[model samples]
Target: MSEAFGSVLWLIVAIGILVTFHEFGHFWVARRCGVKVLRFSVGFGKPLWSRKDRHGTEFAIAAIPLGGYVKMLDEAEYEVPAAQLGQAFNRKPIWQRIAIVAAGPIANLILCVALLWVMFLIGKPDYSATLGPTQGLAAQAGLRDGDRLERIDGRSTETAMDALQVLMLAAIDHRDVAIQASDANGHEVQRKLALSRLPADFDQQNLEKAIGLVWHFQVAPATVGTVTPDSASAGLLQSGDQITAIDGQAVRYWNDIAPLVKQWGERGGEAMVEVDRQGERLALLMQPRQQLNPDTKQQAWVLGITPAPRKAPEHDALRRYGPLEAIPAAFRQTGRMASDSLAMMRRMLTGEASAKSISGAITIAQVANATAQQGPATFIFFLALLSLSLAILNLLPIPVLDGGHLLYYLIELVKGSPLSERSMVAGQYIGLALLAGLMGLAFYNDILRLVT
Candidate 1:
């Protein structure tokens, strides 16, 4: 299947699963608390399929797979019958009503924890801090190939990639990054180095010259892993031929050669490729097919050759844990993620983080698809994180959410009575407007990302 179609399919699955679980939480909790749940729905809009249970709750699968909801028997809108008043959400004690409203988000949180625990048991790919030298300007700056960076500006490096990112960000600002390192000599050293930045007309050659660091991991040479029967790559290159160079440039590594091949498509001419087959260097002249990088808005070449898989380092491979250990670790990881997300949200609100980083449905869909591709364990972990986010967001005491309901309950507790119906309705409308505005902004950002 096409990647785009696959992405859409995965997105549907993700939303469907998450929404179902979320609504189910409310249904289960309300039923347990003696509150009558009128409906438990997966998705919104018109119901595609629905069935009424003995308890009078309609369980449904709706037409829209974007979101779902749970409806409770409450007098918030209509008057409750005296016979069923005991089971009305609004007639319940403040605490019980609060529990019924809060259960949905709490269910999401619980799902996240369970998924995370399972993910930890299944394992995940990891990497250590390692750096390789890039050709051109960076190599000239006393940075040697195969040099593992230890630190930058006196900050200890957790990974070599982190150190390089600092340098790249500094380069973007035309500033020098102070690097502290342990070279081949095993002696610690430090240097303030300036990075080369690409001009406005940044191409492959200049891009390579500007930032000069490479990944330490080894990737197989550009060889056909899978070929579309009549694709450009299949027509010109064979599966077993090891790609040696693109154009006339010597391809030192897989990363070095791939972009060059992609550039061939933009040039719209014959690309001179050097391939090694059992020690024989064969030159193949091939034309690149034009393609667009949807996310980047850049034109590029297409060969349709999947590169060979790279081996993950032992330390980077997934590690399984005992059931006893997994529980605590899962809780710790979940807490940390929750805390970090809250911090980031606060930072975004305060303008400490760039608003451009605020992502919407597009970003969420992309992440969900990517995580699902990694396997069930990884997908589950992502779902968990998203669940936690949902739980936290709903608990913000904003009207139109569970937290808003809780806030009303709290006011009832303090004032010895519920807020006036008109006041409650006004708050709900205000909250809905605020949420709509936020959604609009997020969607706008998503479109900007797609177009740009």
Candidate 2:
């Protein structure tokens, strides 16, 4: 399938699962509380498909397929018969009302944990968090070459992604943190990362650039591992030869070789290639064969030599556990993610982090497609993360959300009565405005990311 189609398809599936579970929580709890539920709908607007259960509760799959809701029999929304007044949602005890309202987010949290368990049972592949070349704050804090990252602020980081995530948050909050790593000799070293020095305009999206932490593989040596037969370098440049310079220009890394060779081929002349063959320096003059590059669809130079592959670093980890062990692991993982997410929210509120950090449906769909392509484990992790985020957002004390209702109920409990209709309506409008602003910001960030 095309990328756009794949993204849309996955987005629909993900929302379907999360929304269904959330609605189910409310449906199940309301029934248990002896309150009558009118409809259970996944998505909104016109119903595409619907079925009525024995209790006359209409369950529906609607046209929109974005969100779902459970409609409870409430005296506030509709008139109730005298005989069925006990079944009205508003007539229920304050605690039962609170339980029913709180169930949706709780269900999402449960789903998040369950997804994480499945993800852990199937390991995710990721690059090791090996510390590469360091500059600025990283170098000043004593981070050195060939060091494999072990932990940040006592939180263990097993992948490059893990280390980068912790560093990004720390940089956002300008929190100086202690880190642990193993040197090239397999000896442990600890240092304080001076993230407090990060400039106010630091970009969370490009933390590596601001922090000066690069992967070792990104700076591979310019050593030739293979030379194609009858190619320009076939007879002259043997395997294991390090291309130090080309046409009197320095070839600092493997990436430098290609462009330099292209320049010489375009100039249509023999170029002097310097090599360090097992530490013995030698120079050879050879002309590059010019050919149309199929991938780029342009005429380009060809030396027909591939760079030597770099070995995997020491801290490589597979995030898998046995089925029995995965239970606790899943809970631990969820707690860590939730903590990190809340910290990010706090920083954003305090203006320590940019609001552009938020993402809307567009970004979610794109990321969903990418993670699905990566593998099942990664996709599962993404789903769990999305579910947890949804749960937390719904719990916020704003009107027109699960959290907002809970807040109103709490006030009702304290005052021994519901708020005035005028006050409740006013709260709803305020809640809607806040939600609109947040969604606008999220969409703006997603579009900005697409444009730039």
Candidate 3:
């Protein structure tokens, strides 16, 4: 219950911050354009908290936390006094109105860049594109374990994250992706991955599994670090004990031990463990326990022994940058994300990608909560990504959105007059219907995810 509440709280905070900045853009632009601001609100419905400024603008926190708006004095909405007619939004020039309408999404994009800039300044964990295992397309392409990814197609990939981003788009389009990688001996080689074999119901989350590219990180030794209380290995295992074999099979890396123990546990069998304690060899019988995997939340075998920490190689670092470099990098990051989002959207529209990839409030809340728990830097990164997503989503040419309004304004600019009220009202109805269907699809995807 507490966890659920915490997720809700995080979601509310994230929405509130994003909405505030978004609405502020419209409010600020309108005021600068000589329009009379009526109410500046974060969220919709009844005002939860409100204050009227000396300028007669009402600032409000409303009941619904999903979205917000900056209401300005407009002749179309209400009767304007002759004296204040010049200050009405409807009286503003077409350019001024366009600027006001575009400001909200622009602010979100700016916020995304700002957040990324801060993130780079503070530094975040980084890793190379080291391969652990290759199967499917990757294996067919002759990608080997320990190979370091250099580039995808012509784009240089500095890290695994970069490669993954490229691969995701390539998979969606069923494009043949070219890659340059460094072998174990540091020899650069090129390979082409054909993604045509990927199933139509491709799961984005399991891209690595589908493409057969496992992320390789620093591997721990077989030495135990700490034992969990009342766990399967608590009594039988001790800190600093070096596990040699599992069920008479010799194990080298820590990853080698897990599957063996898990297989034994699933069949309710014991692990015939052999460990070297100090200089003495000892035979110990350990039984694995059924525990919920923290990530998958599925029943899995666990010995409850934390692996000893391994020092990260110098190559693996938190990529840090100064203000000057960070700003440019942030812009590039924002652009890259925006481009990727548009590509994914296009793929979905063309039926090359599943609509299930669309995430709703439930998924957003869960991600926000999970990222918040990871650390402040991670949470901030998540927020930046979300800000970009919000900006792009709002810019879609749909009715009842800023983009829709901008579209109408563009038409008015070209036609030398505003759209007729009857046409505008009909457009609004159509937009509402499209939006409702989209929302329903998103909700259905979210619920299906939970069930499956």
Candidate 4:
């Protein structure tokens, strides 16, 4: 299937599953509380398909699949029969009402753990937490080649991803952190990473570059994959050509090309570009093409050649757990993700983190498609993250959300009554306005990412 179609389809499937679990939480709880559910729907708006359950609740699939709700019998919303007065939600005790409203987010949180458990049951392959020769911040921090990272800020880092994640988060917050590593002699070493030394204009797209940490096995050979049509290297460079030098500068790895390209592209001169093509060395003098770089949005010179796709090397790390062991692992993983997510949100509110991190449907769809393509384990991990996000977002103290309703109930419990209709209505408008602004910002960030 086309990528776009696949993205949209997977997004729908994911949202459907998450929403069903959320709404079912309320449905199950409400039923157990003896409250009559008028309808249980997995989506909003007009019902596409529906059936009446034995308990008289109409279960439905709606046309708009973005959100769903459980309609409970309430005296405030509809006239109730005298015989069914006890079944009206408004007549229930304040504690039961609170439980009913809180159930959705709680359900999402539970789903996150369950999904993570399944993911752990299926192993995840990862790169070793080994680095090449360090430079800049890393070198200054006393890290070096052959050192394997063991922990960052006391959290174990078994894979490259684990180390990168911790480092990136610390970099973004401009926080110095302690790292523990093992040297070639198997001796433990401790170092403090001065992330504060990071340049204000560092490459945001490549957080690792600013930290000067390179994966040991990720350095690909300088083999040409494809040359962009009509560019400087179009006719001169061929596939499988190994670039040996650019403008008389030695090029040993794919990562070595960009700096040289920029250096020559800025000097405004035709330079000798040497390549080994089928064991014959060929040299071509060509002026590096100059154009605006989309990512950095600055004028940059380029050869317009892409590196060949590398084959998957042997995995140096794996995260797998037995069925029983996965339970606690899932819980721990979920807690960490939840904590990090909350911390990031807090930082964003205080302007300590970039608001550019916000993303919309486009980003979500793309990520869903990518993870699904990778494998079931990765897809399950994505779902767990997404599910946790759903839970936390719903728990926000905004009117019309689960947390907002819980807040109202709590207030009622304290004041011995519900708020006035006018107050509740105003709160809803304010909540909608806040949610709308966040959505707009997320969309803007997503579009910005696509273009740049």
Whole-structure CA lDDT of model 3: 0.87
Q: How close is candidate 3 to the true structure, as a TM-score?
A: 0.82
TM-scores of all predicted structures: 0.68, 0.84, 0.82, 0.82
lDDT values for all models:
0.72, 0.90, 0.87, 0.89
Q: List ranges where model 1 is wrong by over 4 Å.
A: 134-316
Model 1: per-residue Cα lDDT over 417-443, one tens digit each = 999989999999999998898888889
lDDT of 2 by residue, 258-291 (tens): 8888788878988799999988999998999977
Error of 1 at 163 (Å): 9.5
How much is the lDDT of residue 429 in candidate 3? 97
Candidate 2, 84: how far from true, in Å?
1.6
lDDT of 4: 0.89
RMSD of each: 8.5, 5.9, 5.8, 5.3
TM-score-better candidate, 2 vs 3: 2
For model 3, what is the alpha-carbon lDDT of residue 384?
94
Clashes per model (N, Cα, C within 3 A): 3, 0, 0, 0
For model 3, what is the alpha-carbon lDDT of residue 191? 92
lDDT of 2: 0.90
lDDT of 1: 0.72
What 10-residue stretch in candidate 3 is worst by lDDT?
311-320
